[model samples]
Target: MGGLHADHAKPDDRPTGLPTSSATLTPLVVKMLRHGRIAAEHDLLDIGTGAGGLTAIAATRLGSDRVTSVDIDGYLVDAARDRLAGMGLSPHFVTQDATDALPGDYDRIVATVSARPVPVSWLQALRRGGRLVTTIADTALILTAWKTPDGGATGVIERDWAGFMTTRHGSAYPPGLDELFETAREADGENVKLFRYPVTDIRNNWEVWSMLTISIPGIEVDFEETPEGRTAWLAHPDGSWARAEATKFEPPTVHQSGPRRLWSELESIRNWREVEGGLPLYGCRAVVTPDGAIHLSRGRWSATIG
Candidate 1:
């Protein structure tokens, strides 16, 4: 599925209880198909059947009998079923949590939504030598792996970046970090330092953003251009917060509070990239063990996600 924000004309009017802002775009569906390397004979599992667009396409490619689509929301499932039915197609549509046990073993599993440390059930359901295409939650890292004989999967991070809404357990997602955000807004941080670099918006920098998400999960960031300069705020669930301001070629003035120095961590990653030329997030080797741990290795550095 696409991102969680709706594509309504009114910015304040977003659909509730929906899996994503919109159905997976056609180009992205094509990309997933290309990366999945699906075959006409392969039985495919389409996780997160948001609007049935991907399911329809798969059904059209492979027979409808060979396609199974699932989602957590009954409403979405029914809607997707109806949409497909209208087009004279009836792919299997199941209403179940993507993280939960799936129905049948398949040769290909493609998830439009993102998952953290991909669910173990996916590996179990995937037929040996089958491929699974998905993105990691909160990051633009797209992973496509082939199931191995040792009950593990090995793959490389694709150089292309794409993000989808994180998987949800219910009709709607839980509330965001409102209380934590409010606290981070005014708390007197533990330390402050001058950032000897130009203010940079991390969101626009996909490589750094992806690396940071993997290294430090649950960090929320916001940036805007102000009369004072380029201003940015970084907040963490653990009460860490930082405010930075800079203009043109001048260094940034930073104010930080809370236990962790969030800005320092960001700067450290940036410094590493400055020295290394690029982050290891892309083109890295990913190994998913039977226990649901995702290990990423590139050069001499490695990290594990459980």
Candidate 2:
């Protein structure tokens, strides 16, 4: 029950035995491909060509001659090429760092995994009216923006959230909890009343949280689970805290850490839900500044990106 499970499932559409670029790609990428926009007879660039599955799909839609694929790993490029060759689709594949200057501009650019922040260089790479679709890091931060006549771009968040590996640059990501597990386990905190909230899912929660981060500033959330229970951590750089533990909803027990009562925040959301019904999220409009700030706008609470 903890791991990923699609309750209302759809059949797997990926080719059997293909090297997947990322776990998030399969159904999501295939569904995007089926829409037939990325493949429409236009020149395109596929960044981070993992195993050529997406490249192969792009080639089928846009013709192999019209698509150019780039990857940081030569071996992966070669392997993806081999896979594409077997499919009789020979897209131009190159072993090069996409963070550097990519040769030639095109109508579209898509990256499966991006570790680097969305650099202004990406905006410059687009021809007027071109589009860029990429997931920022591994978070479900999907950016789909179209070029503006003024040389900037605007886009909306994709419906789902995806986590991807960090870019191969400095300041990638903080060490996982495993690295600090001993510290957290040894720390003492106050026991508090258990508060219950129905979390539909984390994937759809980004719009709300993202909007909150922008507005609240320095607010952060962390999640972990163990045999003991499920836990969510809310912390602020200013030293506020909230911790939730759910072993059973009948009367869950929670731990409060730091000055701020963190469970109270979740409780506030839950109380709102009781009166307003479930909140609407997903497909929210996101505006990225030229300087690489992310902003999520829901109805009343707008979260900002630092």
Candidate 3:
């Protein structure tokens, strides 16, 4: 609720304070922390402590003395500090890149940010039975893991959808989108196909599928909107991909391309959709080895990490 813009205050704006999440996902995340059953005495680590809104919640729920928050931006660090102070909560705040190395041992480490392969050092910083929750950017994956005695963690993808700003060691994201799109548009063999998949609404599916895409072959997801229309893409590394466009209705006109027929895969899952039933987008089990291998499952097709 901290640093909430007037426009974002509206119920339709989808506010989560963090980039990839919405207010709707906040309760889910809190539920996850509760299910993990961390002790009241356990230390909590909050990575990418945006405006300290969630940090304040974590402090309240986990105890102020037991929480620590870290961020890469000093400005944000200071701003969040003030916000936390406003709420009369004092959790240690650090201005450092989370991917480097975290300070102190924590029983629950939660990141509202995204990063590359999780560093092995993060595991070292965890006490036994500690847990880590984060979203991956390149693939929009959410990971919730626990530290085991053997140095690996096991958890699950709560949902398959969510996106976060990539962890920045420096200023921010690299400039590559424009060039990449231009290249794709200019390619000579610009053939296109069409289809549709029953994807969980982006607002609610933030954890499971996000992690699944990183390991799956030819399942890249992208979104674009213009005055002309709104569009989404699900591409694969193997050159097979699908595109869905909506100029008016909630349903979109789907287009696809490449050899692997990605839209067909999504349609396979969509055909089984039932009343009050959609493909499992969240609550899928996940396991992360010390070596950084991520595995996700839900009694059907499974996906892995890079």
Candidate 4:
């Protein structure tokens, strides 16, 4: 999660790296699209046509005319179109951003990118009784919602967890928290103490990290290994930072400072999860207002994101 730059979607051949669009679609993709419940007669709009894995599957299975795929990078669309055509498969490939006016009439939509507030354009583009499958950005929480009568949607955060790259409006993503990570690396403070919990990389723990992203918001994580032990660094837009270090499977000495004690809050959530057996984020109801605000609730726990 640290010391590296990343692309939101899968590998693409934008005159950069990799070859022709992926012809050998992986099982992971098969499962991902299967969750969309693609049927022979279903009209599908596939978002983030990265590597053309899903595009190939959809076109081959449902026929090219029944499937439409879009990507922000025209090069990706062009590359995928040419390669799929080489294999006698051609789906409508649009050179447009997925967040904008999607270029298709679809009864089922599957996005390989995450959306923070689940775009309203998606709802507008989906036909009546249509289904949408995507993830909430910054979290591995999968959302599968169906169109409602009032131009809104209702669904759930699936019991399962998976993710893709976040949605982008251009060729690349915005600048990230490199400055914050630099600050976290060079800072000296006395907020030191040993913790009972082991030094764990929160990013590797899907449930906790996802829930923390929901509860804390705007937190960026970095991690690395050292001769002494493993270290995890957390930073937020509010100028908060926390670092924890320890040997394998051992208690960590923590250092933290800022308006909020980021590590302390994470520990609290972790403890809460332990006491309650599991986190409430999974298997919760997700309701999308017409304006695209997502309201999620499960029993007594609830949160809203826009």
Cα distance off (Å), candidate 4, residue 268: 1.1
Q: What residue runs in model 2 are displaced by over 4 Å at the alpha carbon?
A: 1-25, 34-36, 114-117, 136-138, 160-163, 170-174, 177-181, 190-193, 198-229, 232-243, 258-281
By lDDT, the better pick of 2 and 4 is 4
lDDT by residue (18-97, candidate 3, tens digit) is 33222325764565456446677889887777667778888888778899988877767887788888889889999997
Quantify how close model 3 is to the true structure by its C-alpha RMSD in Å.
6.3
Per-residue lDDT, model 4, residue 128, is 86
Give the better candidate number (1 or 2) by TM-score. 1
The true-versus-predicted C-alpha distance at residue 277 of model 4, in Å, is 1.3
TM-score list, all predictions: 0.90, 0.71, 0.70, 0.90
Instruction: Give the Å shift of residue 134 in candidate 4.
Output: 0.4
Candidate 4 lDDT tens digits, 1-306? 111123334465233321222233477677678778878999999888877888888899999999999887676778789989999998899988788887757899988778988888899999989998998888888999999989889999988877667777655566667787787777863488877788787887999999899998789898888787898999998888988888987988788878888888889889988999989999999999888899999999999988
For model 1 the TM-score comes to 0.90
Better of 3 and 4 by TM-score: 4
Q: Write the per-residue lDDT of candidate 2 for residues 106-152, one digit (tens) a residue.
A: 88877776543475656677788888877755355677777777666
Give the per-residue lDDT of model 1 (tens digit) for 96-183: 9888889999999999999988998899999999999999987888999999998879998998988888888765677666676566
- Candidate lDDT (C-alpha), each: 0.84, 0.61, 0.63, 0.82
Question: Stretches of candidate 3 above 4 Å error?
Answer: 1-36, 136-142, 159-163, 185-190, 193-212, 215-230, 234-281
